[model samples]
Target: MTKPSSTDRPNPLQVACSSCNLRELCLPVGFSGSELERLDGMVATRRSVKRGDALFRSGDAFEAVYAVRTGFFKTQVSSEDGRDQVTGFQMAGELLGLDGIVSDHHTCDAVALEDSQVCVIPYAELEALSREFGELQRQFHKIMSREIVRDQGVMLLLGSMRAEERLAAFLLNLTQRLQARGFSPTSLVLRMTREEIGTYLGLKLETVSRCFSRFQEDGVLEVKLKHIRILDLAALRKMVNSPC
Candidate 1:
């Protein structure tokens, strides 16, 4: 048998929904082979965005949703005070542009945190396909439902959790999401800056730093700038679950 070379490996960009590694985490779930081919047709094209570039700015018309094929992104909303708040972070296999659907225009800015590639699922085509496929319709609704649930959890974190609890919960959530995407659950390279994280967690930058230092002193984790190595996942969990 001829030996397979690097060229033989599947190219992520060329792979269709039926063969994509992220199929389990994307829209391909619950779709049959024939359905997957049809689903692929809805993805009009692939787009590349450079770091620090806006995928879609607030007030831009919403035409499609994007599936992250590579790299990370952050969504933000600007306040009347001229301050910007980090709303969420997105990684490979996750969907973006949903915030635009309700109003027919993007409500926040989706910016690339790294050089990224996304599969563009044109909204009209996707809606038409969903109408023809009952399973697809249900799956799309389920995805939107999870997004709503995630937002509720964020509200709970901000309203009730203490600084440590909020930070811990944030780490735990990030770790779990990374794990789901086949990355290490206990280690991560933070894509957003500390200030952005503080904004999201409702803490000051110094407060976020203090929490990280305190966690390290307690042997819970090791932090070196953007890189983090979680040493005591159970301890972090306990901190998040403990009463304020």
Candidate 2:
């Protein structure tokens, strides 16, 4: 795991959650004016992480949760045999470090896929604020619930889906997330390498490459290195929904 350098430290500049454009998509969603002010006060700093640097690694003390302001990140864990398994990918407007809430220590490493910015919300202050504000507590609970559901979805994908189905599902999910962030739904530049994708999907690197090649041959996608364009969105969806 890459150690965080001095440059990765949180900047002292105050983050204004109320005025941040990502408010609707982040923790401040649906907050009243006064509530937003409280949140803005709680989120005191913004941190920048350069590509390939870890924001936090396994067993690190967890002081706060970070809300992604820009760029992407992947959460991974090292296996006993020294293999790293990609657990999940996070993008703008998503929260990281939630995995630490239970034990007060991170269980996985969060590495930036590109230069990224994040708003730091101190967990202690956030907890206090949530206790005082019912709406905030509800929103926080909802976010946690969403994470649980996502984990379950990943389990289903890995446990039952075929190689082609897993790849198609991954692309569809990635495009949908990008579309939610106002990017084109059918086209994307992959931030993680194919090997990383295979790690997350529980497939071999060679299998991942062959799956992409097959998709290209079937006119389901146009792939150029890291860039991918979905030529047959319906076909891809059918692959995911097709019988096991």
Candidate 3:
């Protein structure tokens, strides 16, 4: 018997909403069994992206939304002055390209942080389907509302929070998200670079490094390269809540 080629290998991570554990955390929440089946049909194809590849570049034509099936991504925007800012990081089960729905063009670039797969859900078809399914319409509204709230939180972090407070809050937020996906709350890998973290937190790269070292000295967390271990989550929480 001939061995199968690499192209013929099956992907263990390629799964639809009906079989995905992340369904509860994604657009499929509150969807009935039949509704989930219908959603599966909307996902016409899954596209694989390599690390550092742009899933969709800024100002790209937006035809569909993507659901992360595996791996992580970072969305960023470039300023008029050529400075790029990290807007947000997306993980498995999250939706991307929603920023394009209103303007018909992507406002930010979505780059894969690792080899990833995303289910392509055509925006036009989704809109037509939502018109027929009230549950889906409501769920989509909730998803967009949640994104707004998340953006507001980022604003709060950058506008008023101190450097340490921002970092602590960021760690807590990451831990919460990973925990939701059945991952370890105290340990995880950072997909983005330190400079990216500093960019998102509105801090200098040196300051971000210093803050991490300070946290380690304070027993709040242990950071080695991109890996982080939460040594004292309560302490980190206290730092986030404490006034500067």
Candidate number with greatest TM-score: 2
**Which candidate wins on lDDT?**
2
TM agreement with the true structure for every prediction: 0.92, 0.94, 0.93
Model 1 clash pairs are none
lDDT of 1 by residue, 171-212 (tens): 999999999987899999999888889988889999999999
lDDT per residue as tens, model 3, 106-198: 999999999887887899989998999999999999888999999999999999999999989999999899999999999989998889899
Report clashes for each candidate as comma-separated counts.
0, 0, 0
Candidate lDDT (C-alpha), each = 0.87, 0.92, 0.88
Poorest 10 consecutive residues of model 2 by lDDT? 5-14
Could you tell me which 10 consecutive residues in candidate 3 have the lowest summed lDDT? Answer: 5-14
On the 0 to 100 scale, the lDDT of residue 185 in model 3 is 97
Q: Tens-digit lDDT track for model 2 on 183-218?
A: 999999999988999999999989999999999999
Q: Model 1, which residues run further than 4 Å from truth?
A: 1-15
